[model samples]
Target: FTNPDSTLLTKAGHHKLCHYIALTDAFPLPIDKEEVSWKCLVKGAHRNEEMINKLEALEANSTLKSRVIDYVWGAGSQLRGELIYKARVAVPSAYSLPGSVTEEELRKALNWLIQRMQLTHPDINAKVCWPVLYSFAQLTSLKACTCSEDKPWQHPIFPHLIKTQWWGRKGEAKKLGNKEDSNPFINTPITLMALVATAVRPFLVGLNIF
Candidate 1:
């Protein structure tokens, strides 16, 4: 999200998605792009501010391919004191795919999966929201959304995925899935947090709904 002067975009008062996307140097090549064929383009394909900074670093450096965000409970905390109920997170080289992988090979292998899902769930044939793609070092996106259109006949695939995460309330996470705990936190827990991405939902919810 660096600006033209390399200042972070969030510094500005107003910015559109296009503005941030411009920073990433990404272009559209969706699963359904018809003219060129999705298969030809994506032979294989594949989060946070500190996370974002980390990925950008990896993408910049050709020598490195991945990094790790260790198990912790402190990300949401002001002091980041807690360390219970956690999942290890990997910071992949999102823009850069790793060695020993090729797009043609991944497309051929995943073709069966794509076809099978379409055949098995004909309902999704229109929606086209299955087969979430997390791919090689090179096969990654800076940002994407994957929520469906919900209305039929519209493009079913929206881009809403990046990593695999497990979320739990603080108490349940404290318990770490133990059955005996008398109290399990019930609300949506901050299993993951980003300086970007999740801000607008709460903003709109407060402005319109509440």
Candidate 2:
């Protein structure tokens, strides 16, 4: 058993343990050309090539058809007419491993994990909604599609709403005498307004008053 917190395990020990687990559990090896080349030089390139080709054939035969989206929603909203956006999301660091793999393979694996979460978790699905709105708004703003008209959420009506919300929050932050709380939005009106507009659009669409 590997103990992640154990002081006895040096960095190299932890890495070797991870490598053993990856190999034994048949996880995708981390892309490590140097390590692969070294192994090939020691064990003979033909033998290594034969093993890799067999693994590739097996992977091709068993590849799943499902796909996953690469992004997540950053939930932003208004509270009591005050603009608020969620804290920045933190992505966990990728596990360190050594093996040969392409960028596409890594992307596919990550997306697969996301798809699994979306299938099994309702909370994650709800959190994803705002980011989807953000992405849509960005694409529409950039005129990435053939649709020529502006989205209802992108109209001028919402910026006023956002500005009002922001000033209200600024007042509240001042009353609380907290420098940290007040400073976050002090010079961030434009950025905060954009996030607020993105957050508000979905609800507006649902209300069907457009």
Candidate 3:
């Protein structure tokens, strides 16, 4: 269901809603002729008409514009449609990597997803959170690098968590039928639970905040 809160109209909220739609397969084709097509879901979520117009204009030149159009209009090839469907189904699990992922790695992966989303929906660039998310990712990366290893804080299996986590579980990468193998990094989800847990764990020490 569409979010009833007016916050859905904000740029950040709009992008979040878009991601929700993708992850949940919520944008179904209209059953009745009078009902708006799935494409209008994105259009209707925007609060600012002028911004939407500007974004629509700019989207014509975006690198991901064609794919976005194809996804929205349901005009992609059979293979493309199947791939999109599979990606949506896999998104929720993509957040859970096999090994311990550092806060920095999690944040970087999340920011990468957000940036990719913004590219898919250019209107999200209007949100101030865009840069805030980027800065947070960088700060987390720096913090992770500076932490002492006296307690063996770094994960041994995936010491370079960011790179390996994005590439999926080692040696378990799935291959599509008859076709060449997919990129190991392509299906990974940037999960929020891991990021939140990692970011808050240090603060939870000696305090029963649960």
Query: Which lDDT tens digits does candidate 2 get at residues 105-165?
Result: 4343334323332211111211111112554374322211111133423433343444454
lDDT of 1 by residue, 1-210 (tens): 333311221222112222212222123233322222212112111123443454355357534321111101112231111211111111112111123435443343234323333211112212112233666434433222122334432211111111112223432234335443442222322222221123212221222221
* Runs in model 3 lying further than 4 Å from the true structure: 1-21, 26-45, 51-71, 75-210
User: What are the TM-scores, per candidate, against the unseen true structure?
Assistant: 0.17, 0.21, 0.18
Q: Please tell me which model should have the higher TM-score, number 1 or number 3.
A: 3
Clashes of each: 17, 4, 1
C-alpha lDDT of all candidate models, in order: 0.25, 0.30, 0.33
Q: Which stretches of candidate 1 lie over 4 Å from their true place?
A: 1-98, 113-172, 175-177, 180-210
In order of lDDT, best first, we have 3, 2, 1
Best by TM-score: 2
* lDDT (Cα, tens digit) per residue for candidate 3, span 1-210: 122222222333334333333323333344521122224434544676654654464357554343333343342123234333443433334333213455544455445434333212111211112123554374322321121224332322212333332223432222222233443223333332232223223322212122
Best model number under lDDT: 3
Please, what's the RMSD in Å of model 3?
19.5
